[model samples]
Target: MTMPDINYDILRRVAETASAYRYKDIWITVGPEDGQLVIRVHDAKPTCEDCAIFPIAKVDYGSSPSVEVATIGSESNPVDLLNLEVPAGQMIPAGTYAADAVFWSQSAVEKFMIPYYASVYGDQADVVVQTLLTVLKPAAQDGSEPDPAFAIAHLPGSEYVTLANEGLPHLFLIRQSGRVEGAAKR
Candidate 1:
Protein backbone atom coordinates (compact mmCIF):
# COMPACT_ATOMS: atom_id res chain seq x y z
CA MET A 1 0.00 0.00 0.00
CA THR A 2 1.13 3.52 -0.73
CA MET A 3 2.04 5.44 2.40
CA PRO A 4 -0.27 8.24 3.37
CA ASP A 5 0.91 11.57 1.99
CA ILE A 6 1.37 13.33 5.31
CA ASN A 7 2.26 16.98 5.49
CA TYR A 8 4.78 16.86 8.31
CA ASP A 9 4.87 20.65 8.69
CA ILE A 10 1.23 20.62 9.75
CA LEU A 11 2.00 18.04 12.41
CA ARG A 12 4.94 20.15 13.57
CA ARG A 13 2.75 23.22 13.87
CA VAL A 14 0.23 21.38 16.04
CA ALA A 15 3.05 20.05 18.19
CA GLU A 16 4.38 23.60 18.56
CA THR A 17 0.96 24.79 19.60
CA ALA A 18 0.76 22.13 22.29
CA SER A 19 4.23 23.03 23.55
CA ALA A 20 3.46 26.74 23.53
CA TYR A 21 0.40 26.13 25.67
CA ARG A 22 2.46 23.94 28.04
CA TYR A 23 -0.04 21.10 27.96
CA LYS A 24 1.16 18.29 30.22
CA ASP A 25 -0.39 15.72 27.95
CA ILE A 26 -1.70 16.28 24.45
CA TRP A 27 -3.63 14.31 21.87
CA ILE A 28 -2.90 14.83 18.17
CA THR A 29 -4.66 13.26 15.23
CA VAL A 30 -4.60 13.78 11.45
CA GLY A 31 -6.87 12.26 8.83
CA PRO A 32 -9.19 12.90 5.93
CA GLU A 33 -12.14 15.03 6.85
CA ASP A 34 -14.26 16.52 4.06
CA GLY A 35 -11.56 15.40 1.59
CA GLN A 36 -8.67 17.32 3.22
CA LEU A 37 -6.24 16.34 5.89
CA VAL A 38 -7.56 17.64 9.22
CA ILE A 39 -5.36 17.68 12.31
CA ARG A 40 -6.68 18.31 15.80
CA VAL A 41 -4.91 18.86 19.13
CA HIS A 42 -6.45 18.68 22.56
CA ASP A 43 -5.40 18.91 26.18
CA ALA A 44 -5.39 15.25 27.25
CA LYS A 45 -5.71 15.90 30.98
CA PRO A 46 -7.95 13.17 32.36
CA THR A 47 -9.94 15.60 34.47
CA CYS A 48 -10.27 18.57 32.18
CA GLU A 49 -13.53 20.09 33.41
CA ASP A 50 -14.26 21.88 30.16
CA CYS A 51 -13.13 21.44 26.55
CA ALA A 52 -12.49 25.20 26.50
CA ILE A 53 -9.47 24.58 28.69
CA PHE A 54 -7.84 23.31 25.49
CA PRO A 55 -6.98 25.72 22.74
CA ILE A 56 -7.84 24.23 19.37
CA ALA A 57 -5.86 25.47 16.34
CA LYS A 58 -6.18 24.36 12.73
CA VAL A 59 -3.98 25.44 9.77
CA ASP A 60 -3.65 24.50 6.15
CA TYR A 61 -0.52 23.23 4.50
CA GLY A 62 2.27 25.81 3.88
CA SER A 63 0.62 28.41 6.09
CA SER A 64 2.34 30.59 8.68
CA PRO A 65 2.25 29.25 12.26
CA SER A 66 -0.03 31.25 14.49
CA VAL A 67 -3.00 30.29 16.63
CA GLU A 68 -4.68 33.40 15.29
CA VAL A 69 -3.91 32.47 11.70
CA ALA A 70 -6.55 29.79 11.29
CA THR A 71 -6.80 30.03 7.51
CA ILE A 72 -3.50 29.50 5.75
CA GLY A 73 -4.48 29.09 2.13
CA SER A 74 -7.01 30.26 -0.39
CA GLU A 75 -10.73 29.71 0.07
CA SER A 76 -10.50 26.27 -1.48
CA ASN A 77 -9.84 23.45 0.99
CA PRO A 78 -8.89 25.64 3.91
CA VAL A 79 -7.95 23.55 6.94
CA ASP A 80 -10.98 23.59 9.20
CA LEU A 81 -10.34 22.50 12.79
CA LEU A 82 -13.20 21.21 14.85
CA ASN A 83 -13.53 21.65 18.58
CA LEU A 84 -13.27 17.96 19.49
CA GLU A 85 -14.12 17.05 23.05
CA VAL A 86 -12.18 14.44 24.94
CA PRO A 87 -14.09 11.33 25.90
CA ALA A 88 -15.74 11.23 29.32
CA GLY A 89 -17.71 8.03 29.96
CA GLN A 90 -18.12 6.39 26.57
CA MET A 91 -17.55 2.69 26.26
CA ILE A 92 -14.58 1.65 24.10
CA PRO A 93 -15.55 -1.64 22.50
CA ALA A 94 -13.52 -4.71 23.28
CA GLY A 95 -10.65 -5.54 20.83
CA THR A 96 -9.90 -1.87 20.23
CA TYR A 97 -6.34 -2.70 21.20
CA ALA A 98 -5.85 -5.34 18.56
CA ALA A 99 -4.08 -3.35 15.86
CA ASP A 100 -1.84 -1.09 17.94
CA ALA A 101 1.20 -3.27 17.54
CA VAL A 102 1.08 -3.16 13.75
CA PHE A 103 0.39 0.55 13.63
CA TRP A 104 3.19 1.52 16.03
CA SER A 105 5.72 -0.67 14.24
CA GLN A 106 5.75 1.37 11.06
CA SER A 107 8.17 4.21 10.38
CA ALA A 108 5.14 6.46 10.47
CA VAL A 109 5.34 6.86 14.26
CA GLU A 110 8.91 8.19 14.02
CA LYS A 111 8.36 9.92 10.73
CA PHE A 112 5.35 11.66 12.18
CA MET A 113 5.49 12.15 15.97
CA ILE A 114 9.05 11.67 17.22
CA PRO A 115 10.65 14.27 14.96
CA TYR A 116 7.89 16.79 15.54
CA TYR A 117 8.31 16.56 19.31
CA ALA A 118 12.08 16.62 18.93
CA SER A 119 11.85 19.82 16.97
CA VAL A 120 9.31 21.43 19.28
CA TYR A 121 10.43 20.13 22.68
CA GLY A 122 14.17 20.21 21.87
CA ASP A 123 16.31 18.57 24.58
CA GLN A 124 13.30 17.45 26.54
CA ALA A 125 11.75 15.56 23.65
CA ASP A 126 13.68 12.45 24.54
CA VAL A 127 12.10 12.22 27.94
CA VAL A 128 8.66 12.76 26.49
CA VAL A 129 9.11 10.11 23.84
CA GLN A 130 10.72 7.71 26.27
CA THR A 131 7.92 8.11 28.73
CA LEU A 132 5.38 7.43 26.00
CA LEU A 133 7.23 4.39 24.72
CA THR A 134 7.79 3.11 28.22
CA VAL A 135 4.12 3.35 28.97
CA LEU A 136 2.68 2.08 25.70
CA LYS A 137 5.29 -0.39 24.45
CA PRO A 138 4.60 -3.11 26.96
CA ALA A 139 0.97 -3.15 26.02
CA ALA A 140 1.96 -3.55 22.42
CA GLN A 141 4.08 -6.58 23.32
CA ASP A 142 1.50 -8.16 25.53
CA GLY A 143 -1.31 -7.50 23.04
CA SER A 144 -3.33 -5.74 25.69
CA GLU A 145 -5.18 -2.73 24.35
CA PRO A 146 -5.35 0.63 26.03
CA ASP A 147 -8.59 0.96 27.89
CA PRO A 148 -10.62 4.13 27.64
CA ALA A 149 -9.11 5.16 30.97
CA PHE A 150 -5.55 4.28 30.00
CA ALA A 151 -3.85 7.63 29.80
CA ILE A 152 -0.19 7.89 28.86
CA ALA A 153 0.48 10.60 31.44
CA HIS A 154 -1.31 13.28 33.41
CA LEU A 155 1.43 15.27 35.13
CA PRO A 156 2.51 18.85 34.45
CA GLY A 157 5.31 18.30 31.97
CA SER A 158 5.75 17.76 28.27
CA GLU A 159 4.11 14.36 27.76
CA TYR A 160 2.07 13.32 24.73
CA VAL A 161 1.35 10.38 22.46
CA THR A 162 -0.32 9.83 19.10
CA LEU A 163 -3.19 7.33 19.07
CA ALA A 164 -5.82 6.19 16.63
CA ASN A 165 -8.73 8.59 16.68
CA GLU A 166 -11.38 6.78 18.63
CA GLY A 167 -14.03 9.01 17.16
CA LEU A 168 -13.45 7.99 13.58
CA PRO A 169 -13.83 4.57 12.00
CA HIS A 170 -11.59 1.79 13.22
CA LEU A 171 -10.04 1.59 9.75
CA PHE A 172 -8.49 5.01 10.25
CA LEU A 173 -6.86 3.85 13.46
CA ILE A 174 -5.61 0.76 11.67
CA ARG A 175 -3.76 3.00 9.27
CA GLN A 176 -2.36 5.71 11.55
CA SER A 177 -1.81 6.25 15.25
CA GLY A 178 -2.47 9.98 15.14
CA ARG A 179 -5.46 10.83 17.31
CA VAL A 180 -5.60 11.47 21.03
CA GLU A 181 -7.50 8.73 22.80
CA GLY A 182 -11.15 9.76 22.83
CA ALA A 183 -10.31 13.29 21.71
CA ALA A 184 -12.10 13.07 18.39
CA LYS A 185 -15.68 14.17 17.90
CA ARG A 186 -17.81 11.08 17.61
Candidate 2:
Protein backbone atom coordinates (compact mmCIF):
# COMPACT_ATOMS: atom_id res chain seq x y z
CA MET A 1 0.00 0.00 0.00
CA THR A 2 1.16 3.51 -0.77
CA MET A 3 1.84 5.82 2.14
CA PRO A 4 -0.13 9.03 2.27
CA ASP A 5 1.77 11.95 0.82
CA ILE A 6 2.57 14.88 3.09
CA ASN A 7 0.52 17.98 2.37
CA TYR A 8 3.12 20.42 1.14
CA ASP A 9 0.40 23.07 0.96
CA ILE A 10 -0.05 22.84 4.69
CA LEU A 11 3.71 22.94 5.11
CA ARG A 12 3.91 26.01 2.91
CA ARG A 13 1.19 27.66 4.94
CA VAL A 14 3.10 26.96 8.11
CA ALA A 15 6.31 28.27 6.62
CA GLU A 16 4.62 31.43 5.37
CA THR A 17 3.02 32.05 8.71
CA ALA A 18 6.34 31.50 10.45
CA SER A 19 8.10 33.82 8.03
CA ALA A 20 5.42 36.49 8.26
CA TYR A 21 5.83 36.40 11.98
CA ARG A 22 9.60 36.84 11.54
CA TYR A 23 10.69 33.31 12.22
CA LYS A 24 13.45 34.18 9.74
CA ASP A 25 14.47 30.69 8.62
CA ILE A 26 12.06 27.83 7.67
CA TRP A 27 12.20 24.58 5.70
CA ILE A 28 10.29 21.35 4.91
CA THR A 29 11.49 17.97 3.67
CA VAL A 30 9.62 14.73 2.76
CA GLY A 31 10.78 11.18 2.24
CA PRO A 32 10.23 7.50 3.09
CA GLU A 33 11.96 5.20 5.54
CA ASP A 34 11.47 1.58 6.57
CA GLY A 35 8.33 1.38 4.49
CA GLN A 36 6.92 4.46 6.26
CA LEU A 37 6.48 8.08 5.28
CA VAL A 38 8.88 10.64 6.78
CA ILE A 39 8.29 14.37 7.01
CA ARG A 40 10.83 16.55 8.78
CA VAL A 41 11.48 20.19 9.59
CA HIS A 42 14.91 21.58 10.57
CA ASP A 43 13.59 24.84 11.92
CA ALA A 44 16.39 26.34 14.01
CA LYS A 45 20.12 26.10 14.66
CA PRO A 46 22.11 25.69 17.86
CA THR A 47 22.20 28.80 20.04
CA CYS A 48 25.87 28.82 20.99
CA GLU A 49 28.62 29.81 18.56
CA ASP A 50 31.11 27.50 20.20
CA CYS A 51 28.61 24.72 19.50
CA ALA A 52 27.89 25.62 15.87
CA ILE A 53 31.55 25.60 14.85
CA PHE A 54 31.65 21.87 14.36
CA PRO A 55 29.55 19.49 12.28
CA ILE A 56 29.16 16.93 15.05
CA ALA A 57 28.50 19.64 17.62
CA LYS A 58 26.39 17.36 19.72
CA VAL A 59 29.46 15.31 20.52
CA ASP A 60 32.11 18.00 20.19
CA TYR A 61 30.42 20.98 21.85
CA GLY A 62 28.89 19.10 24.76
CA SER A 63 25.12 19.85 24.92
CA SER A 64 22.76 22.23 23.16
CA PRO A 65 19.18 22.31 22.00
CA SER A 66 18.91 20.56 18.64
CA VAL A 67 15.31 20.60 17.46
CA GLU A 68 13.85 18.42 14.70
CA VAL A 69 10.54 16.82 13.68
CA ALA A 70 9.48 13.67 11.82
CA THR A 71 6.06 12.30 10.80
CA ILE A 72 4.59 9.20 9.19
CA GLY A 73 1.33 9.64 7.26
CA SER A 74 -0.87 6.68 6.48
CA GLU A 75 -4.65 6.69 6.23
CA SER A 76 -5.38 3.43 8.04
CA ASN A 77 -2.37 3.51 10.33
CA PRO A 78 -1.22 7.04 10.85
CA VAL A 79 1.60 7.36 13.38
CA ASP A 80 2.49 10.43 15.42
CA LEU A 81 6.09 11.48 16.14
CA LEU A 82 5.87 10.65 19.82
CA ASN A 83 4.51 7.15 19.20
CA LEU A 84 7.22 6.08 16.77
CA GLU A 85 10.23 4.24 18.13
CA VAL A 86 13.61 3.18 16.81
CA PRO A 87 14.23 -0.53 16.58
CA ALA A 88 16.40 -2.07 19.28
CA GLY A 89 19.32 -2.68 16.94
CA GLN A 90 18.97 -1.24 13.50
CA MET A 91 20.16 1.70 11.44
CA ILE A 92 18.08 4.28 9.60
CA PRO A 93 17.56 3.21 6.02
CA ALA A 94 19.23 5.20 3.25
CA GLY A 95 16.96 7.35 1.12
CA THR A 96 16.74 10.78 -0.48
CA TYR A 97 15.38 12.82 2.39
CA ALA A 98 14.86 16.57 2.24
CA ALA A 99 15.79 18.98 5.04
CA ASP A 100 15.16 22.72 5.50
CA ALA A 101 17.27 24.20 8.30
CA VAL A 102 17.26 27.76 9.56
CA PHE A 103 20.46 29.10 11.12
CA TRP A 104 20.18 32.48 12.85
CA SER A 105 22.69 34.29 15.04
CA GLN A 106 22.04 35.33 18.62
CA SER A 107 24.53 38.10 18.17
CA ALA A 108 21.92 39.93 16.15
CA VAL A 109 20.28 40.90 19.38
CA GLU A 110 23.56 42.01 20.89
CA LYS A 111 24.40 44.07 17.86
CA PHE A 112 20.92 45.60 17.60
CA MET A 113 20.40 46.14 21.30
CA ILE A 114 22.16 49.36 22.23
CA PRO A 115 22.98 49.91 25.92
CA TYR A 116 20.76 52.99 26.11
CA TYR A 117 17.58 51.25 24.84
CA ALA A 118 18.10 47.87 26.52
CA SER A 119 15.62 48.45 29.31
CA VAL A 120 12.83 50.31 27.52
CA TYR A 121 12.80 48.35 24.24
CA GLY A 122 12.30 44.77 25.27
CA ASP A 123 10.28 44.12 22.08
CA GLN A 124 13.31 42.72 20.26
CA ALA A 125 13.90 40.07 22.85
CA ASP A 126 10.24 39.15 22.88
CA VAL A 127 10.10 38.87 19.08
CA VAL A 128 13.14 36.60 18.93
CA VAL A 129 11.78 34.23 21.55
CA GLN A 130 8.31 34.19 20.03
CA THR A 131 9.60 33.58 16.50
CA LEU A 132 11.77 30.69 17.61
CA LEU A 133 8.87 29.13 19.47
CA THR A 134 6.43 29.70 16.60
CA VAL A 135 8.74 28.14 14.03
CA LEU A 136 9.40 25.21 16.31
CA LYS A 137 5.81 24.30 17.26
CA PRO A 138 4.89 22.61 13.94
CA ALA A 139 8.05 20.53 14.10
CA ALA A 140 7.32 19.69 17.72
CA GLN A 141 3.80 18.64 16.67
CA ASP A 142 2.68 15.02 16.93
CA GLY A 143 3.28 14.30 13.26
CA SER A 144 7.08 14.08 13.49
CA GLU A 145 8.44 10.79 14.85
CA PRO A 146 11.79 9.12 14.61
CA ASP A 147 11.85 6.16 12.26
CA PRO A 148 11.81 2.85 14.12
CA ALA A 149 14.54 1.52 11.90
CA PHE A 150 17.13 3.49 13.86
CA ALA A 151 18.14 3.32 17.53
CA ILE A 152 17.55 5.94 20.30
CA ALA A 153 20.28 7.04 22.68
CA HIS A 154 20.69 9.87 25.16
CA LEU A 155 23.47 12.45 25.24
CA PRO A 156 25.79 13.55 28.06
CA GLY A 157 23.71 16.27 29.70
CA SER A 158 20.28 15.87 31.22
CA GLU A 159 18.79 17.75 28.25
CA TYR A 160 20.33 16.36 25.07
CA VAL A 161 18.04 16.47 22.05
CA THR A 162 18.77 14.18 19.13
CA LEU A 163 16.43 13.22 16.32
CA ALA A 164 16.28 9.75 14.80
CA ASN A 165 16.92 11.23 11.39
CA GLU A 166 20.49 12.13 12.40
CA GLY A 167 21.28 8.52 13.32
CA LEU A 168 21.49 9.13 17.04
CA PRO A 169 20.76 5.61 18.19
CA HIS A 170 23.52 4.12 16.08
CA LEU A 171 25.95 6.96 16.58
CA PHE A 172 26.01 6.81 20.35
CA LEU A 173 25.58 3.23 21.54
CA ILE A 174 24.62 3.25 25.19
CA ARG A 175 25.96 0.20 26.98
CA GLN A 176 24.30 -1.65 29.84
CA SER A 177 26.77 0.06 32.19
CA GLY A 178 25.36 3.49 31.24
CA ARG A 179 28.52 4.48 29.41
CA VAL A 180 28.10 5.47 25.74
CA GLU A 181 30.22 4.14 22.89
CA GLY A 182 30.96 6.26 19.85
CA ALA A 183 29.90 3.82 17.11
CA ALA A 184 27.54 0.88 16.66
CA LYS A 185 27.39 -1.06 13.45
CA ARG A 186 23.99 -1.23 11.77
Q: What is the C-alpha lDDT of each candidate?
A: 0.35, 0.30
Best by TM-score: 1
CA shift at 19, candidate 1, in angstroms?
Answer: 12
Q: What does candidate 2's lDDT look like per residue over 29-120, in tens digits?
A: 33454554343334544233111111111123344445465433345543333223333333232312212221123343234322312332
lDDT of 2: 0.30
Q: Report the Cα lDDT for residue 156, model 2.
A: 22
At residue 153, give the lDDT of candidate 1: 16
Q: What TM-score, computed on C-alpha atoms, does each candidate reach?
A: 0.28, 0.18
* Residue lDDT tens for model 1, 1-186: 222356555455455446434423455544445455444555553232211223444333454334433221236533212211223332122212212112233344455555744665565567645543433333454546543222221211112222333321211221122233432322
What global local distance difference test value does model 1 have?
Answer: 0.35
RMSD of each: 17.3, 19.5
Stretches > 4 Å off in candidate 2: 1-4, 7-22, 43-186
Candidate 1 residue runs with Cα over 4 Å from true position = 1-15, 18-85, 88-106, 134-186
